[model samples]
Target chain A: MSIKQEELEEIYAFAVQLGKDAGAILLERAQERFDGSKQAEQGHIEKVNAVDLVTQTDEDVEAFIKSKITKQYPSHKFIGEETYSRGVSRDYLIDDEPTWCIDPLDGTVNYMHLFPMFCVSIGFIVNGKPVIGVIHAPFLNQLFSSCSGKGAWLNESQKMPLTRNPTPPLPPNAPSGCVFSCEWGKDRRDQPDSNLHRKVESFFNMASEIGGREGKGGMVHGVRSLGSATLDLAYVAMGAFDIWWEGGCWEWDVAAGIAILKEAGGLITTANPPADPATAAIEEVKLGSRLYLAIRPAGPSANETGRQSQERTVREVWRRVRHLDYSRPGV
Target chain B: MSIKQEELEEIYAFAVQLGKDAGAILLERAQERFDGSKQAEQGHIEKVNAVDLVTQTDEDVEAFIKSKITKQYPSHKFIGEETYSRGVSRDYLIDDEPTWCIDPLDGTVNYMHLFPMFCVSIGFIVNGKPVIGVIHAPFLNQLFSSCSGKGAWLNESQKMPLTRNPTPPLPPNAPSGCVFSCEWGKDRRDQPDSNLHRKVESFFNMASEIGGREGKGGMVHGVRSLGSATLDLAYVAMGAFDIWWEGGCWEWDVAAGIAILKEAGGLITTANPPADPATAAIEEVKLGSRLYLAIRPAGPSANETGRQSQERTVREVWRRVRHLDYSRPGV
Candidate 1:
């Protein structure tokens, strides 16, 4: 299942092209809607409720990417957000087989609104791990790509973290100086103890003054939500955001992003606090875990390696956030 | 003194160039930080609190812009974030005389994080109204500009909204289908009645299901925070976001944005609901109101004009959000 780095780069280039082609489709569809020439889009937009949404562009781009990838790699398996939502077999989740995981439009809501945060994501996975990934945001004109053992990049030239140098070490007090990212997912039930309520409460705790909230505050420097988990992950990979703690997103959301993140020297772990908070070993989250924590690449600290800095950030955030449950269907 | 449209466009051009130059400075400073070569920035950063931040670049850009503007137009008064923060007289708040309001670095937090949401905002006001506006985001390569009687623009070629056409009508059901923007500002105390807590609660109510929580939910189509009010304002002007309800930001934060929004045919009102929900008249917020609601341009509906659509959207949001109080200095 181990592919040569050269072959992985080949797949990465294919994915980069596939992602841009798909993004072109997204941009066209969005432009039509924005131009008010998309009277049919109103009928094309089907809501899974008021919060969760899917558009015809989502389906078209997913189909377009699937067709192209299958044409190029006939033997490869494929898992796509639109297809998976239509009741695809769970056997394609991840396995020893080479699979292409795609979120044709990662930020569908943003795309629908012409908010400029939507993108097309493609990840090549083998042995249940992403080896090559590409995410193209047409509106922002940013394309992020990575291959195993090959450094991550933006728009084919600049190395990620956008610094053209090694990422700086995590700032002192770690998450206290961090620009934290977390999403308010589609589930907005307001029960006293619902995950939605807990998520909001967690944001409150993370943003509260250090001594103002009964020692429950993390007082992270800032909180941002761009309405797209994939972009959040990419920014974390680029070192724009120090950490991204997310729940209720799917494998398609993080599949390609995880590849770019790891290739850029970042780390992804379980969203929830580990059972053993003091455990030194980092446990990467499963592809379909539905909850994830991603920390940016950091240079080695005087007393800690980059891995140790990421681990510390993950655990400190674990202390401040309530455990969130996002179950996969039939899990 | 009434100024000609030609004069406003002239000021708009000047402001656009000034914003670009200011953005270049911001980009250089941010590049230095991200490049890990900004040893001086460490000493240059000064925090107003754990959340509020200022940098030497903020001060330097302010001084640079002040010098440039004063040299070009000696009679024009200027108010900038950094200079005003160090204590400027209130007479410049919004007088009969022409004044320039600048946030040399509007999203300082984003700039410090290299998050790409920060920008340089230059606003020209005459007799208490934003007449000429420009905002430049160097990282995103976006430059938004507007004149009093002229149209708003992005990067000077594509029109605001990027549709190359008039804006579409607001969707039926108003905020129910609206992409909403609101900021979690620096004030993060967790008192039961604190503005921060209430703001969070309002978000919960706005995002929940239509019938949930005894009718408090607005069931907004989406909630997004880019961590920059100016960008949020710019996007609203571009018709990317349907409505933005914000509190606790200053005149410097929104001055230029108001001009762009108005030129793009968007509406600005008090963030609070109207005293009478049944009233048909739309009220515009003052330069220093601290609470503001911005709605994107809309084409006419079956029975409602574009203005009516905006007023309806504003009132619908008002019904769901708690009233917020953010006082101006020594008011």
Candidate 2:
């Protein structure tokens, strides 16, 4: 199931084309938002428009993607968000099957508000590993795509870091005081140990300034809940955000982003304290882990100072916000 | 000194041209971010680069704007962010002398980090009221502008709301559950009753759930700190955000936005309880009041129901997250 770098690039280009087509459809539908039909479904609520965003467009776009993928790779299996939202269990394996994971519309809420943070994500997986990824943000007119070792880019010209291709590993030193991103997902069941409490505390920990929150505080510049996870990971890969720790988003949300991010030299680990990607089998990272700590992309040649600085930041953060385990053993 | 509608429109057009020229400068400088030379001066800190940011660009842009204004009006008094940052207190009269409020660069941190949320804000004033405003976000390529009675607009082609010219006043109803925007200003000093503490509590209150935060919890959807006060107001005027509560930003940070928001049919008041903007003296709402609650814009001829719905949402939010008074009276 090993994909040639050349094959992956071809697939990556195709995925990008598919993303562009899907993005065009999404953009047109977004403008009709003012038509107002608040049919909130699949946990997508527009308190203002009350639109029945049961997101028919979501399915239509996915269907379009699957049709295009099948035309090229008839044997590739497909996993779409709408299907998972329809109650499909999170039990798919990246095993032998060549798969195309799709999230027709990531950031549905932002799309509902026309807040300019939604995207079309497509990832190609084989032997249970992502080798090609494409994330197109139509409104922003920026597209991020990657093919394993071929390097990652924005619109295929602006190599990430916009400083150098393949960013060096984070400088190892004390955390450089980062701005973070987190979210309070739709799961609002409240209790002392509930997801709501954990997220609130994590957010507070990130924004709490020096001399606050005891040992659990962070010198993070701030925390933003932009109501979208894909953009969070994509932006972090771009080095705009320092980290994105989450426990509620699904596989489709991270699949493509994880692929693109890795290509750019970033690491993704569980959100809990021991999120040591260094020791974990990279492929063991699950779509259902439900927790991810995405650090900014670094370059392979990251110098000792850079590595130490980045490691210092990571260690400090892990000490403060520990996440509850949501991953199962041996997928 | 009352400005006629026609005169205000002309001024707005002139102000927009100034903003465009200024925006071109800001955008070009942003490209040279890797060319970092943090000059720690005048409370501006570029911790990592520590290059001499002694922002000659800020001065350069301000001088550019002032020269253009003097050429046009010849006698207009100008208040720029860099000048204000240089110790000119916010105590000037909104006197008969036509004045210009400028923020050559809003969201300086976002600018420093290349986060795509910064902008150039230009506001024209006469007789103590903002008559014309222009905000140009070069990266986003979206320009928001307006005159008192002519209505707000985006790129001057798509009107604010982009659908309804003037949005209907918020309907009278329980808090329709809003998406909020907030910021943690530079003053991080903490105390049980300090402004820092109040902001932290207010932020937590908005995001806390049903049984959370004692009686001080709101059902607001989420919050974002995009690092720019002017853009926050401009977006709310565009109907993308519901409320922006701040007690740390200055007049220049909000003057242009206030002019744009008012023109779009929105309300501006103190962040504390009983923020009655309909009766608040327009001039009394100073550039340094330091505590302003900007409501979403409403449509012309808003129905009673719409007005009450919007008011209800506002009152509900105020009840949950009340601000401590931070304003000085008798301006």
Candidate maximizing lDDT: 1
Give lDDT tens digits, candidate 1, residues A254-325.
889999999999989888876776664678878888889899987775798888788888877887788897
lDDT of 2 by residue, A253-322 (tens): 8888888887777767667766563343333356667788787765443345444445555666676675
What value of lDDT does candidate 2 attain over all alpha carbons? 0.69
- Candidate 1: docking tier: medium
Q: Candidate 1 lDDT, tens digit per residue, B194-258? A: 88888887888888777776787777878888888999999999888998989988888999999
Question: Model 1, stretches more than 4 Å misplaced?
Answer: A39-42, A45-47, A88-92, A163-166, A275-281, A329-331, B45-47, B88-92, B162-166, B278-281
Against the true structure, whose TM-score is highest? 1
Docking class of 2: acceptable
Error of 2 at A194 (Å): 2.4
Per-model i-RMS in Å? 2.5, 4.9
- Flag regions of model 2 displaced more than 4 Å: A34-54, A165-176, A275-285, A299-307, A325-331, B34-56, B88-93, B165-176, B274-287, B299-303, B325-331
